[model samples]
Target: MKNFKTLLFITLMGSLCLTAQNNDTKRADKEFARFEYVDAAESYLKLVENGKGSDYVYGRLAESYYNIFNTVEAERWYAKALETSNDPEMIYKYSEMLKANGKYKESNEQMEKFASMRPSDNRATAYRKNPDYLPKILEQGKKFNVQNAGFNSEQSDFGGTLHDGKLYITSGRNDSRKTYGWNEEPFLDIYTLTENSDGGYDNPTLVNSYINTRFHEGLVSFAPDGNTMFFSRESYFEKDFEQDSLSRTRYGQLYLFKATKLKDDWDEVESLSINSENYSVKNPSVSSDGSTLYFASNMPGGYGQYDIYKATINDDGTIGEPQNLGQKVNTEGQEMFPFISSNNTLYFSSNGHLGLGGMDVFYTKEIDGKMAPIRNVGIPISSNADDFAFIIDEVSGEGFVSSNRDGGMGSDDIYTIKKLQPLCDVLIAATVLDDKTREPISGANVSLYDDQGNKVVTKSTNADGIAEFIIECEKDTELEVTMDDYESRKVALQGTSDEESPVQISLSPIEKIITPEEIVLNPIFFEYDKSNITAQAAFELDKLVQVMNKYPELVIKATSHTDYIGSDSYNQRLSQRRAKSTEQYVISKGIDESRISSEGKGESEPKIDCGTNCTDEERQMNRRSEFLIVSGGPESQE
Candidate 1:
């Protein structure tokens, strides 16, 4: 009996030790899943340090180290895993890591080994299509220490809005009622979190029963007062309730719900008048003043699949007509999730234009009643993932964006972004001059180049004959100035400083004349039976102003001629008047009148033989004015 008891004690101790070891491994796996890669790697390293380095443990350790960006440690464990096991998944991942680390020779060998082991697997063939596919952006994002907000776990939490020291995030977590039809995703509702004294967030609580329905709701925006809320909701009641429902409406629609603070609590949720049955609207954005509402919709007469529309808030708190923003603001592809910054600068997401793929954030400004060209906020804030639903604190440059890239809890995760100061201060200013006089030349192209010889910024000279580009210059920089028909001048500044000092550049005008081989002008109109200039003649004269503006050094002569339908003296007087009218109109349009000379050729310069009996059209064609390049101006021969 004593001998049997000693054996049982030994077996029981061994079983307890094995169970503890398995529990540790599972804890490490959970840590990795939570994106605590360094902690997971430390746990796996302990197992490796002990005499328990199995192939599975080694491979998992390598992945954890890779996530932590410890390439050296990752490579070491990957080699151990390859030596210990013939797992196809392990081999494939190891090969990819090797390729990413530029160990192509060994990477190719491992890939061949994986391919040979699984001949029927076509993943290797598909991967070869984009062999250089490195998720560089995602790899960098993993370094950011993002913490899960500890909201509902089983639902997707995204599209957070910070207002009045509280955070509101949308989630699809299940509700207690459970009466709502399940969407393809979990049921979504808005939950609010207040800020703690230590700059951390408190436990999230449901905002109100009025706003938290058991249906899909997300992408909420609040007015400046925080009393009015706009959110997206999808209703499938027509299809989900009916017995033979065939409704195909699966898209989200925008809804405005009013929440008034009454007795220290928000009460009475009601929809706004902007909600329409004709179109689906989502992603509402109100201007800082709260007078205009901008939202994304797929209504007719839009530029693309989805475009941003604006509706004015009437004095009586009603919405005006929905106006399409036109092609200038909208594109041929979907543009959504617009957010108006404090300065009224419009920021939105677009998938139509050139980008890193998925939706990229673009910003535009409404200046002088027209939307300026949309500018992409490049790099860092944007990536190849769907980086959208971003909101920035007006006072601070701190903002948050939602992305589904790797290193997140699951699905989409919210990331905090803080803008750093300008990298380099390159004071790029240009002084334009008259080439012949060596004076200032206005409206010339001044561009800045980086070390890679790519143009970074461009600006044209202002009316003061000075063009300035406040370039954020780094070490090695180049500046280039170009003008029409002129030799482009480039200056390389080595070791440029990031100081506030300015660098002035000079641009010489072009010496050569680039006249078109054939010149055609729209026929000038005249009063009936009269050859005098009219307001209609000002249209052709404006074209001459444009030509003079582009080619400042070219001189031209305006010759006016009349057909044989009138007397010689009358034709000469009319021709001279016409010539003076053209020259005077050019001067009025801001062109230097000295660059043009007028001549009256009367009936001598007719292109066709038009007698007194000719048709009105033929006579009108002969009674015309023409422009010819006479000579080079002061700067033309520079």
Candidate 2:
């Protein structure tokens, strides 16, 4: 999708719709139906200039430019076409143009209109479900910390490669060159940069003129030794391309060329033998050993418009036939800018797969002699605009990526990428012992909970009374410890450290009381609207578990309750699930299921009479799990 073709005579998806067939419009119809979009666009503009333009002519012109990805012109004509037309598809296309130009609010307006017209369409239904999705997309998770490269320009600068303290990039910074019809920008050229010790960059200078022509040239990749370089150039430089007979148009394809870095300058620039007159070959990404060359192509036998293809580098320097990366990497749409890391992971950009609207960067790693599922690199790296050419240093966790997102110095600017530590990485190490005797409590139950109150892991203390877990170092890591006739203990671990310290806990022994009254143990609390036992709750439950184990014939009943946030029926269902979960946990720890029964009290039995006006602390008391002795005490079951 980034190639930005001139669109002379393209391979059409199918025959285009035609409304006029007179001699004047006959030439335009043939060009339009064949998907000669640029030629079609030119002819339609001529008709408009001659005062013979109609709704069909204006619509065809918009569709032609849109197909060729000229959003600037497409937006102009789509606006004109929609003034009197009600075509739902055009509305969707208009929305796409508005989005590509960063007019998201206007885009959503058209999208909502289209969704109302075609309520059954999946794309429309999806847009209607979540029209304001940008904030959520941005907040998904941080994959990279990014900032503008110091050596960017007000033109399209992209395809960054770092080698030996120097940055090699491609850009349209040469204003002396002729403008490209696709984006109305200067043709691409290669540029290099060297950094100074003071963390500043020397101005980016041009590569050798022989390697860069007035035609498009960008995206350079080099060998590990920096002696050999493979890069993309326009096919017009080869002087062996074909032209369409009817249109008499010169079609240019992007091809890969090889050059060697010599003493003072690069020499012996030669086109790769795999160059074809019909298909494109660009975006070269070579291996560190120079044994494998990965590039993007629209050649035959590909699975998509532009698929990532690799050719083996032979010992004698000859190249093998290109191999498509297969359906796992290539889709029915475009895939380009492949980078094979030193660790053997393939990173590429894709638009066919599900993403956050435009091209999102995805990575695929090999496992067991096959490619694994492709994973989106996630937000802060990908956006609604085109994001590609991603590379990262796996060791230092710093690299670069190219994006056309808003607030850049150019249409496509290179952004420096850096990796930061995850939000959490705290390890939990806990120990349980008697408070007075200072003796280790063996086989004591311990549970770990994350900051979100999720039961992450559960383990029992060993002979040394230790339970350790490596978790995301978070704000509120809770640990629970309990033993027979001992007061339940709960401890919260919170700090940041590369090394974790053991959370030592001590429990006090409780006096044995023989009474006919049931002992109301402290409330085993849960997070809001949750049923699973937390680390704190687990500590309290373990006490009852130990007491029941001592008195083998003892029976207990657990009643769970919820606050006034939900409906009566729903809260009853939720509390029932909570009670069942608690009972199951006790049974799993060597207790008989028949000795434990559970019931849901819902919000009807709130001990805090504050009711609906209850504070969070008061609500916490309401959402409780209580245990009562039913039998095997001095008294019988009621």
**lDDT, candidates in the order shown:** 0.66, 0.77
Residue-wise C-alpha lDDT for candidate 2, range 165-223, written one tens digit per residue: 77789889888989987899999888888888866566788888878888889788887
The per-candidate count of clashes, in order, stands at 9, 6
Instruction: Candidate 1: list runs displaced more than 4 Å.
Output: 1-152, 175-183, 235-254, 422-638
Q: After superposition, how far is residue 115 of candidate 2 from its true place, in Å?
A: 21
Tell me how candidate 2 scores on lDDT: 0.77
What TM-score does candidate 1 reach? Answer: 0.47
Q: 488-562 in candidate 1: lDDT tens per residue? A: 556776755443445556544332323442124567666655433343354345455555676677677888888
TM-score of each: 0.47, 0.48
lDDT of 1: 0.66
